[model samples]
Target: MSLDLDYLKLKIELFLLRKKAKKTFPEDLSNLTLWSQSTGLKVAVIDNDGFNLKTNLESIGVSVTVFYDYFKPVSQRQEKRKPYPFSQYDIILCDINDVASGNDGFGELQGVGAIEALRYNFPFKMIIAYTGNPAALSRRIKKEKSSNLVDKIYDKQWAPEDFMETFKESSKSFSNPEARWQFIRNRLTYLDAKEKEIDKIREAFVYSCLLKGNPKFLLRADAELENLTQSTLKFLQQGSMSDALRSGLSGLGLISDVFGIVAAIKGT
Candidate 1:
């Protein structure tokens, strides 16, 4: 019997290709109880002209509370702004340009001053900085030193529909802790499904090599298999509690792969 090495290699490669083409599961919020029709997201806007923005948000099932002006005059820009009904809002939108017009002690409180004050003082679940400025959002964030505090930034110039779509994509603006937990649970569930699929494919490939009576094939393929295993483990270990936890899971994956390889060979 001829050992068609080329055909075996082709089969392995095709199987590997399919195994590597992992499905990207987008974040699904449908499972969250907060997504119910009556439970519209509560949003707050700190913009000079937020009527239209509020309307846009409300059209998509958000309950908006607009604060016409963001920053007060020099004497009134308190270290801590009076807290609103915390239970009501999931997100706060601050227009940077609205901050540009505020006279806070030294001069007009520009973007940086406004961002610092809001980030430090405002207690909101999420803060999204928005402006009509032509500068890129990254540039604005860096300039204002609001990288840590600002969850997202939006360009008011973007088409209204595009703006809303991008907001939905980037912001996890959950209504409550339970809702956020549900979001994470959804991701973990999808990840678990992907890992099981990978395990089956890896087992089949190992068995195929063993059946060919090609002991050297295992040596040649081990590194590639290890890479795939590591990738899968890394995906599973996302949002892990610590580096130690991630390392532990990775070690477990290696052990499982070894056991799978041994089992495949023994079965053949």
Candidate 2:
């Protein structure tokens, strides 16, 4: 509910902003579908408060592995156990301030330092930074955006409901490539049939446009899709660049046509 409020507020704000300015790209390019498929999802948490979160996630059927800090060398720490292989996780929730101290492997890695180390070591993994300090977290998020290191940033104090809701939505979308493509196809097929949620339909249309080489839409669809669509489109575009992911999206079906999707959105 709390997470939904933010999205509701965003929709309302976008609707108002659209009236004043020519439709342009949105500042926030968040793709809710990246974690769309969460069945049997693998998650790793690297935070001081990860135990509670890990327990909660596990109750909901999520496979979660918690680690305090990987920056420390095995020789320094008494727990000489095998660490959770970061490569196997679908999502990683990390705290920027959860750092390592003296005589550590990574040399006192803290905050952005820890985040960067994880990003470098696990480039393909989805990393999210969670911290109490919004300002510091935002800075870390921005720094990683160029490299797609961090998929999202949440406040460490996020309400239980909000965080869970967000996690569920993301996980549902995190399905395999074929499922993702099927989802896109289903949304496309219903674009014209769904009359009430025109806003949602337009959003899907905009996201689906990323498959095409160029975007072309009529006046109505163009007006319906403004910043929100642009932002989602950009994120998906970046995500689709990986060879495995691209093949997954394109292998099953020739990426959906942009013009057709635009027309469907316009009901033309």
Candidate 3:
């Protein structure tokens, strides 16, 4: 009997391809709830003209509060120049150009000053620094170590998409139980027989990866995989190999080439 090595190779390649194509899930309320049980995040946006963007974000389930005139002079004091009570939000999104024009103490405000204020006043919150002036954003990232205070930076036109994408990526990392497992499975697919032994070594590496990064999702994934393995073994021990394989593959959404042969042999 000839082994279908070509079919196995294709199956492995496809698995690797799927792994590489896996997108980080967008962060949203569901993900936040999975981790923190928070209903909705409070966000404050400081901009001269992000009314539309704020509206869009609000439509998507964020509790958005806009402090619209970050460009008005401090001396103006005409409702627009008042300092925002920064304590109220989970995240702050600031327009760099607006910061420069608004705060006289910063004197033609730089992104660094905006970042510093957010960092000092709102140490627990995330900051997104956006600017229509690309030069200012770029200068902030390049010349100022203070830019680290901001979690992300984007141009005004792209801020909405970029912000959403950040949430998606974070959400995926937080909520997907199989992310690291899928990562390992993909790496396994590329190995030659000589490297197949590496799978034994991978458990430690995988555990290390989980430990070094976010602990919450890592623990959740580990618990999920453990339960899955236990259930699979129970099915196998009952001489229900076909049921075991089907359940395992279906649970993983995996289609191995050997599955066809197994199914054919089992008359299923």
Candidate 4:
């Protein structure tokens, strides 16, 4: 996994990883028809990247949410920030440096660390590295072990044609239901570290609540938005969420009745 490997090794590793992905991924292309007619992909843009690619990306159909200074939500740089719901995003584009004001081991390149965390915890989602500094990628990817996880890298100065091509390749996973499941499950592992009585939360939300909708999967999504930090939602300023993804989690019953059931489970 060392970044110092020769070009041959790099190509070999990349090939193997990509091959493994193609072979092991769970798929159900039946919903693909739903995608083309929908609002395109759900994109989370870390560090904003100005408006350069935003309008262009939207033109092709993706709904983008810019978490302007994700890592440094507060004035204090010591605090580690929380990511939004995994099921909420389809693709994540992150910059490697100058992401607001903070450092959680990645120093000025905190976005790389943030991207690494997202990739490790949610492996199935499409993650693209978008940055003005390629040198920062060399410096940060090595330390973060994120070289292979990123699907593609788009320089901030990339030509319109180049970015359009990148989008074409990256959006292929939009039709993947299995990949979406992995994204949700892995996020639970990360959330478990901070939330208490997670199993209870899942049961109350999914079986009782979510079962109302996607009964096939007993995974419940929380009804109480209180469990999520204000910053997580606040940062999603212009989040253009799609109805297709009202929630990877869906449920029935009164929000009061369903949410009241899990209200006491502290730290969720």
Estimated TM-score for each candidate: 0.44, 0.46, 0.44, 0.48
The total number of steric clashes, by the backbone 3 Å criterion, in model 1 comes to: 0
- Give the RMSD in angstroms, all C-alphas superposed, for model 1: 16.8
Clashing pairs in 3: 25-168, 25-172, 26-167, 26-168, 27-167, 27-168, 100-109
What value of lDDT does candidate 2 attain over all alpha carbons?
A: 0.50
Q: Report the C-alpha lDDT of model 4 over 94-127, residue by residue, as the tens digit.
A: 8777553445576766777677676665544567
Task: Write down the TM-score for model 2.
Answer: 0.46
User: 229 in model 1: Cα distance from truth in Å?
Assistant: 38
TM-score winner: 4
TM-score between model 1 and native: 0.44
Runs with alpha carbons beyond 4 Å of true place in candidate 1:
1-39, 71-88, 100-111, 122-124, 134-137, 143-146, 171-268
Question: What is the C-alpha lDDT profile of model 3 across 1-268, one tens digit per residue?
Answer: 1358865664465344334323322111122212221225567788766556766666656688877654334654465544557665656778765554545665544545766666654433457776667676666567765444566666666667775776555323222334323433432332221232333223323322322233333423343334433443344335423332333233221221111111111110
Superposed Cα deviation of residue 58, candidate 2 (Å): 1.5
Residues 1-268 of candidate 1: C-alpha lDDT, one tens digit per residue: 1568875875686465444333312123233222232135667777767657567767777788876665443545456443333334556777765444534542422554555555454322456777776365567557867455466678888898888787665444242223333333332232243445334433433333332234444444455455545655656555433442243334633333222332223211
Tens-place lDDT digits, model 2, residues 1-268: 9989976776565455444233322122234222224546788878755557767787787898877764534655576544345766767777766443332443322656666656655533457776777676565456656435465677767888888888876554344333333444443332222322323333454343322212233333444444445453445445424443333233111222221232224322
Over 4 Å off, model 4: 1-34, 75-87, 135-146, 176-268
- The alpha-carbon lDDT assigned to residue 200 of candidate 1 equals 40
The full ranking of all candidates by lDDT, starting with the best, is 2, 4, 1, 3
